[model samples]
Target: MKTLRLGPWPAIATLVLSAVTLAGCDDDDDDDTPSDSELATEALLRISRDAPTELPDNVPEDLRRVTFGGTQYDLLELLGRPSGSRPSARIVAAYQTVDTPADPPPLGTPSNAVLPDYTRSAPAAQVYECRQTGGVFAWAFLQPEAGLEPMTTTPVPGLETLGFDHFRYPGGIDYGPPTGTPPVGPAWRVSALALNGGEPTFGQTLFVGAADVTVPNGAGNVPLLRLSNAARIDQGLPSDVFSRTTSDGTQVGYVLRLDTVGGVAPTAGCAGAGDVGKRERVPYSAGYYFVEVLTPP
Candidate 1:
């Protein structure tokens, strides 16, 4: 079970361009026409990108072992073959851990009394079999497992309404305390989003709104966009709807891009102080909607 690490938040300008480019590319493709294998591969890549930092080591004891349908391949074997010239092309594995601490001891206990505590952890694994063909990397398969359950593609209802076309346990595996357990599967609730689009726009105003769905980490209550007036204008967009202020504040914004998958755009929106205090409003075209999770200090 290999751990997955996500890079820090991408620059605002880069994110905007990437989103525009992806939206454009998606517009050019046929709708809902991806092959079953292609769909599986896409899901695997999403899981890999969003997997947690660590996974439990106790195989069947604390973790489930599932075999994905269609193909069976070990981690070493998947990576041994050449993925291609591009750096994003390759098979990857990711592990996530979910845990919660036991409740605290009662107040009137003796000074020397020992306190009993309950602490437990569970693990989930997702594997991505992908390759870089024609300069763009795409997943060929996705396998997920939990304990000993048979691997199957279990549909998660309403996922598409939330902007996800497919949602599955992958290996027909689900693990956690029997119902009514606190903090159950908190750490294991991994969610991933991927975009394979064209070149991004240099200066554009993009809007992203969350579809009605269960918030991943009980964070649904938090506001989606927290914009600092100052930071907004500093990034080069409109100062009216977004501007800078003397008071220290935080704003919620969506990610514009995660990683570049195709030809790089000639020029991306400006970052740093180049466009500080300047206002620009660009038009938007229809395509795939951009989704990102952001927290500001």
Candidate 2:
């Protein structure tokens, strides 16, 4: 397996902006503060900060005041860490492009050429009861019932081209599922350390991705490896690596490839001109990691 190490410091401006925003909000309320409608408003502001630049005007007004189990939380608190498999009472938003032609087809004979017009799908909002009591939040995974089976495939259009789908935790790294297997619907992996103490220290997290090893023309199978304290330790290995760019230009680490078969292309390792070091990979995949943290009350 190959491992690449990324330098820690992110872009200055972005870091500064995020710090300022977080600092401003930290003063808004105290842990002992009672829940109020203002909490919802603050949450909305935080969510909007991370949302896409453009949002549909028709989005529900209450989207900013979503509640779980009869309790309302500000958006910053809701999104503070990795959301496990639990369904979000808040709107789980996504954008999709629908292709339509501006001009109709020719009248006489069918024409082969087609013009593509992209339309954004309306945002969707849903409220569910998935919050954990006592301030801790969890990622909920589905359990198979008697005579029922769990779903293993996810429906992602763009990732299919790359032969993998990316799985993300709320406040942690994003991982890729192996090609060929159906995506798992409600499976989640939690940080090992967080499971023990209810709160994970900075730099302590486990990230995982999945791939099907059962394709007819599949590449040689390799066992998924696991690592602890991925961001803080150095494991000597050469592997294919990946990284994600946060809004502030901080690059978060993801994976390192060990070995592969079946002519799959490796993505470029992290690189940029700056004081930051290159990103490195910590190879592993064991479903998803779920971490539940109790909010200060």
How well does each candidate superpose onto the true structure, as a TM-score? 0.16, 0.17
What is the lDDT of every predicted structure here? 0.23, 0.23
User: Candidate 2 residues 1-297, lDDT tens each?
Assistant: 111122332244234334323433444454444222222222222222222322233222232233345676433334443533232211221212111122211110022212111111211111111234345433222121010011112332212111111222122222222211222221111111111222222111122333222212234332321111122110110111112111232222222122222222123332223312332222222221111122222
lDDT of 1 by residue, 1-297 (tens): 111222442255334333433443445354544432233223333333333222222112111111234433332232233533211112112221212212222111122222212222222222233344555444432322221111112432212211111112112112122211121111111111212211111111112122222111122221111111111111122221111222332222211111112111113333434433332211111111121111112
Stretches of model 2 off by over 4 angstroms after superposition: 1-54, 61-63, 68-70, 73-94, 99-297
Candidate 1 local distance difference test against the native? 0.23
Error of 2 at 171 (Å): 24
TM-score of 2: 0.17
Query: What is candidate 1's CA lDDT for residue 79?
Result: 28
How many clashes in each candidate?
16, 36
